[model samples]
Target: METISKIELRNLQIEDYLELRASMIEAYSGIEDAPWKEHEIKKLLSIFPQGQLVVLADEKVVGCALSLIIDDKDIDDNHTYEEITGNYTFSTHNPSGDIMYGIDVFIHPKYRGLRLGRRLYDKRKELAEQLNIKAIMFAGRIPNYSKYAEEISPKQYIEKVRMKELFDPVLAFQLSNDFHVKKIMKNYLEGDTHSLDYAVLMEWNNIYYDKSPKLINSEKSIVRLGLIQWQMRPLKNLDALFEQAEFFIDAVSGYGSDFALFPELFTAPLMADYNHLNEADAIRELAKYTEPIYQKFQEFAISYNINIITGSMPNIIDGNLYNCGFLCKRDGSSEMYTKIHITPNEVAHWGMKGGDVIKTFDTDCGKIGIIICYDVEFPELSRLMADEGMQILFVPFLTDTQNGYTRVKSCAQARAIENECYVAIAGCVGNLPRVNNMDIQYAQAAVLTPSDFAFPNNGIKAEATPNTEMTLLVDVNIDLLKELHEHGSVRILKDRRTDLYEIKKK
Candidate 1:
């Protein structure tokens, strides 16, 4: 047998109950008039096993610390220990509480000089910090008070302890650990002789606590989006395309959407090459109107005080043709992301070249990325965006058949799940009969989310009917994404085996 003196602190387990209960009895001795039942201890562990911890020395249980979460609003200055703890049952445990209430802590009498209590308190502080709560609050027993109960009041006795005129085994240790006395709690523990049934309220604030209430509740942090499944047709002139753009913007801006997204090549109708030019010639003609179309969308975004993702458009940059997506901010600023993955049709028929950079946009709504049509079909692109802190991805696509649309739709949902992010897709649903190579269209628009408890059942925040020309609006909570990454049922990001494999960009 190994006789080494090794100590370990860890979360309470079901099998540790017998040893833990025995340690509790030895630690409390004559002071524990109301000892905890074994079933009650099991119940506390079942409620929140993370808050209950035990310390072991040489593989033997020697100390334990039990705690429960409580809402700060429910705690008043005059609350007693029993009132806060639900008569020692810990039925008041609130998972969303802002404060961690220490229910009980004890070290076996034989293990008292080993500083085992400090290890238990340290573990509690670590747990509280991991939960991102505001503070750790508990009532401290003044064990030395039995000698002073006849000589001084609870308040006076606490003042003497604070002033260093008297020493309490518990309060003095708590004070040494940076906890401050708040107030006196009377009759905190029933039939307690050491404390005279009085306890002192003590608290230790977590200085690094997150102050944003939005993180705990999704309702407080909403990012509304307007997704437009554009209706396409042959444009009689440039004015016709401008009219359609203005209408969609006016409709969604009234509903107070932070962003309005349009479909890929939404301005393809502007080519109006009634002469029936070939695919390459028609795409080249559309490229000519890119500057004018961008100006118009920029004006619309500023006028309505809404950010606009002007889907994708054909652009001729430095004599090279590329598919580019533009984001026009309400502040009159704009950024562009070119499609890095060019489709076979684009390359073979239009001589389109793929872009070289993969980038994300930082906007008022959130960190966002744009992946055009076929770009989203590749998981690496979305993964890179997510690695860069992108919480939302906008995919603008143009599909000519139901099969093509299904490919994009299914891939979009998978990207949402794999990256734990929101994905909003928009596409053109009608055809420009007069324009060659653009006469057929099949599309749908949808706001997809990660398939997690914090999101919708099907991971679809909102979706337009397939092959329909309509607008869909939905609210996505960015804070919910933050919470999911931290405390979701499965923490994919945190659980990645970086030591075995890694993903990086050259």
Candidate 2:
């Protein structure tokens, strides 16, 4: 047997970064949505020029960890954080210590079998120690859209595919390396529609202040879901959308919700032929509108400290356009996602189709998945998010006809029951006409509990008006979603013929 020698990791040079940038784009080729761009690479390298490290094989850089030790002051003052002054900067400067942030950990596709991810991480931890850093944080993706269809319970849908793709292995490797998940960042990717990534915020401790004592007891988990249908006012412009969102958010902000969701297409002016515009052009316009809106929205979130899911819009990417969602925190940082699956009508006439992958975001509420419009139609989509330990799902959609609305409602309920999670859906009210004179009408928006469709549990708790602009505040108990999925008499996920299903795969 030919034995592979242990590889050594070294700090990447400027040339090495250029090489890694090429590799990162290549590695992400399998992704359906937007791929890594030159600018993102440049930005990362500019922040932490020396943070990147490469693993050598036969003296060649086969794998690398793209990390950055961002100075709190530098990052805070950076253009990215201009919306919120002093935001993202460490409030208390540790004059003697620095924060280690892992931007991305990537391995060359050809040399992945030898546990290069782990090797790179080991070196990463060592580097942190050598630097005497107080804490290490990194953003990680939870593969939600990469799931495959399986015959067993829905939870296995994404898990099975993730296992095959080594997504779980990467996560396990990180955990085994002693990286505790501090928080999950939601919808961090651009132009992604499905809930494909759950930004796993990881950390190693040092100089940051600790506010609370370590409790021996399990921390209480809470959930709040806000459902609102996107009501389009034809004459109403972007300002109207923002005003309506503010009004709705202010109205339901009192529910003490941890996370709230607005309907799909909630952010822009709806036109009969808006889809005819360049998706990116439309999104660029939306982003310009969103800049001021998000500025105030972030401040609103900061003031009320609320985490809000401001529904879907057409997002431009690399000159192409996509239907995407934006998750904004009161803290001024925002994550965006796009609709994965385009409807038959959308794909055939409008050049829109399915999204890239599944992604879940973390918030004060809990681990949640944001799926927009037609993307949620696929069971595999929701199942993938559920398998990744997501407690809640926020669906923003625009459906016409009571049949489609009911089908969506049923799908939401089924997703909750099969995955044993809570599902919230916000849809559009009134009639929305595409430029082609095609109009879709929605019956209502609803919030569903895990028990909504399962036995010993009844139907939907609350629903909005069928043809009116309305907001419904739904109280969600995250613990219940988490607890029921645990082994119980009504154990839905635990008892299954997981092994037998593989036979069918062959």
Question: Largest lDDT belongs to which candidate?
Answer: 1
Residue-wise lDDT of candidate 1 within 45-73, one digit each (tens)?
88988898888866788778889999999
* Candidate 2 vs. true structure, TM-score: 0.52
**In model 2, what lDDT does residue 398 have?**
73
Which tens-of-lDDT digit does each residue in 1-506 have in candidate 2? 11232244677765655666566666666656323355554555555555667776555566677665555454331122112212333232233436676655777676665555765675666566556665676655555434532233324533443355434545555665677666545445543333353345556664323333232223435455667666765645656656777777766765655566777765545443356665434344554454465455654553344677877665556666567667886434678777877887665544554557567777655677888766666777776776677877888877768788877888888887777777788877765454332355665777777663232356475778777877787776666665577644476667656767411110
lDDT of each: 0.84, 0.60
TM-score of structure candidate 1: 0.57
Best-matching candidate per TM-score: 1
Return the lDDT, model 2, position 399.
73
Q: Candidate 2, residue 436: CA error in Å?
A: 4.6
Q: Cα deviation of 397 in candidate 2 (Å)?
A: 0.6
